[model samples]
Target: MKTLKGIKTHPLVQRLQWVFNPVKYMETNVQEDRDIFKTTVTGKGGLIFVNSPEGIQELLTHDTKEFSAPGSVNGILRPLLGDQSVILLDGDRHKRQRKLLMPPFHGERMRNYGELIQKITRSAAAKWKPGQAFIARNTMQEITLAVILQAVFGIYEGSRYDELKQLITSLLAVTDSPVSSSLLFFTALQKDWGAWSPWGRFLRIRQKVDKLLFAEIEERRQNWDENRTDILSLMMAARDEDGQPMTDEELRDELLTLLFAGHETTATAMAWALYWVYREPKVYEKLIQELETLPENADPMTIFRLPYLTAVCNEALRIYPVGMLTFPRVVKEPTEFMGYQLEAGGVLVGCIYLLHHREDLYPEPKQFKPERFLERKFSPYEFCPFGAGVRQCIGMALAQFEMKLALAQILRDYDLTLLEKTPVKPARRGVTLSPVGGIKMMMNGKRTPSKSVAVPATV
Candidate 1:
């Protein structure tokens, strides 16, 4: 019989706060309505933000039936990912697209990328000399981008690869700040006034990226090879249930989606992991001891499965989840959730940030404690950094794999120091949350393999 509570602030002010300081906005609103609250953050029509584990489970578990995960609700990303991107597709089409794209990111296929990830991480880390300062996020971006380019597209070095990498970095840099990121949130500010304008620069850079993507798709189409195992090749060969291949447009959009989603989120995560590990000497020493247990030239999978290392990565993700909210799930029929009645067509998003910070789920949630993960196992809904359900991140496996392996490679090979004593707060980075100032650090020199005996694995 009760209706969802709505934030009393003006719609425009709420939207601005959501864009400018989303963490503050969510924390402020959650204080009023802990379980579920309605806000005009995405502009009017009442978007519900749910953080309670039971509420989230109810929303995501029944996403396919009781609630609909419509792509139209994700229109905000269309400009960057295109309408054909899987993130912007709903229903049967979305399901089909996911099926086709799922192969390369999971199973034994992921094992193949391990060596490549470590190699890329080492190569990037090699560039940092002792006492050299670098931004953790930028370095991680370089590593992730290279890993994706070669692992997903089979491009390591070439004019096309270089141009594509530079252009994509340039494109992302435009929205690096909240003020610049506003162009994506507010349609009114998305005006293209020329190359001098923010939106205009974004459009021009996007055009270049599209040109490169289309070119790559076209070249691959002309020189089709059945033996190619890269994601692009797999996508080109994949046929839908109707036996029709994806169109050039679809391929281009999906490629951009992978390139953006794959590198951007993973890089932010690795940077945060680096920050947490180095910032806490206890975490850093514990992780190093675990990493030293592996034999020289250890199998990437062995490194991947290290217990304390896994805990560190999990804790990092839990603390400041890269993606704040899951893609919106709309109510398909009248439903009652956590004693509140919701009408058909109600919009809902699982607020991952507040959920992870819940006092009940994670005691002392603000502290960076990797031991918590090792202490207790949480249900998917309770510890979902990668938003659960049908729309859960397709690259979830790869992101974690890359995060663990890359962190292992970096930590095991190099000693680094966190340059900032002050905490770096999470700030809006496009649609995801990233560490402000990107976590500055200085390389201390390469670490030699420890002669100490391997410690017993404890999970």
Candidate 2:
């Protein structure tokens, strides 16, 4: 494992925000160079960096139970989710919540949602016009948002879908800007002039989304729908060992967590994947070729099998993961890592960005190459875009499926090129990390590669 026995800092560095120059100061620095170096965040904020594959493994695995995700990994989300949110819970409560939610995202029931994902992707892809500049991030956001709605509500439509979409758009607009991430480091500043402040204005919008969610929960409760299988319906029907249903408050928190998380971060990742494929045409070509080999209207598992596309998406996430750090876990007993003794409750950031860009494991780490994934597969800790340990993203499978289907659908119909020669790096998108300036690109429509049939975006 790589290590720097000491940490260095300058006075000017202390005043900086982690969100402002995230890749510049942390993940990028670690990516373009060595692993296991102690670095200063703002001059005062110090973290022990583990950029090497092996070091990353130790941080995420091995003694994982010791290093808890602490501080502001979910700071911006706290106001919305409250302390009862699964993201805030640890140990037993976390286990129970995770268990309760797990069933909905699994089994053949989950597979049933793939057709909906494909339909949504097709609808969105059909909107692209040749010669027009399309903002990849925005497009993917719409696609994933629609998919999540259907996945969560078992087919949302009419006033509710439009209302929900509008509310979510408003809520995300505040968080999507680079400013929200900066709030993590400076709570007082945010309370004053920060974009997350009331002046930036997201509360009214969130309440609207929440109102719809709770109202739906209430309606469902008044008329229990046994036919429904989406999370909200399942949660409504769920009873603990005591044969008691979950309260509205518990239901609300879980719904809010899934509703907010379901679409936002996945949208960011899909956007980045599109940008990388366009920015690096060869990678896009490879993805297209691989996607072509899939059977007509392939199943989700088959989508997962498109090795090149899978590698490209995975690597895109590794390079520009939406969430910068993993969920916090605290040490219950004394432990040692990086040759330093750690006490219980000691904080550790999962630092996925730094780990993915490790120079030693990923030579010329910044280059967009998906083959590295095929060349050698790193352990979960080494390239954990969705994080590792038991707390790894519950929606990882869902997110990956969406990316593959969406990308495959888009590439099948249109060919695109970068509108700007120089690319923007990932900056904080609200509570997530995404392309800084929005991935601006122009479309180049191509008919089916194998056959001459026209491909329409809508199902």
Candidate 3:
């Protein structure tokens, strides 16, 4: 098989580095070939990595025409999201699944989520006390998990919701360590020895989650409420071209997909945003100043449109994209990509990490400067935090809304200070790159009441 500019590292070393220190792996490879290259990182050999905007645009624009974005290429995710999940569907099925899932996260349907997001953020923030240090990521995770559960299941507070939340959190915690994360990569290690084993614990937690999910689904089926706006209710009402409702198994898989994808990635993104905002005093001051211009009780949409807040979120995503690569797009026929020649069956991934760090596109790329977003406008391909085109994140709008509203609420409602001055590096959190230590911080105290912003009545 032909190759792009190849990194010289041994395949075994590359694979281990990719799993253990993915940021280091990508940084080293980009130094060798900034635009495109090949690696054994995907558990498959000869996968091409393309980071340039031109390559990403071509790959995404012509997706399904010149190249096929097959979901089987995303098998790394299938162990978590099942065979029937939208993330694992291909061809017409992928398109149809995306359509069915898109409505709840778009336009007016998304606006309905704003007040709920702020309520969750405020409630979570209320739990923090002055002078007490805590992991910001955990705090953000708590807020995001609640938001997603409400949006996905429409269950605000209940024993089942609490159980589902606890089990999912525990299951995901298994991936916090390199050893446990490797279990997802090595299929043989997935065998269950007992509840004490890593895979065994994962299976057990997953089973409980499954039971809770099925019970919820069955109850909703027996007493379906058409007026409910949650994603689950929306999906329950939707039918495909064949005029068929999703099967219980299909609903379970899709619900799991939305739950996992919706909460985890957004939580990580918000955590990084909080870290950057506090770490850079100027950024923090400017952000608070912008946020304060609005009434303390500003609506979610009002906060979402704040210029500096948007830039802060954009910079955070650019600095360390949660998912480092787009789902692999395969070469449909013999063709040239960017400047390289490729044959049919070749796999391509838009290397989001490298693209964001391109020195030409972002001068002094490592620096967290929100002003870069303000100074210049970038094309969708150029500034894609979420991957572009056919397989772009279905929840892009909701994620952005959550990040902006939650950050705005936290900044206006309470004061926080980073406990560690040293830079926090990104580490592998399952498939996403998250802050290494979850961004530790101390809550100073609640901000004094001021005319700059008014406290929300609901809080």
Candidates in order, TM-scores: namely: 0.96, 0.87, 0.95
Candidate 2 lDDT, tens digit per residue, 181-232? 4544555644534445553455556667778877877888798769886767
Local error of candidate 1 at residue 163 (angstroms): 0.5
lDDT of 1 by residue, 220-242 (tens): 88988888778888888989889
Which number leads on TM-score?
Answer: 1
Best-to-worst order by TM-score is 1, 3, 2
Q: What is the C-alpha lDDT of each candidate?
A: 0.88, 0.70, 0.84
Q: Runs in model 3 with CA error above 4 Å?
A: 1-5, 449-459
lDDT ranking, best first: 1, 3, 2
Worst 10 residues of 2 by lDDT: 450-459
CA error at residue 139 for candidate 2, angstroms:
0.5
Task: Output the lDDT of residue 221, model 1.
Answer: 85
Whichever of 1 and 3 has more TM-score, that candidate is 1
Q: Tell me each candidate's RMSD, in Å, in order.
A: 3.0, 4.2, 3.4
Error of 2 at 101 (Å): 0.9
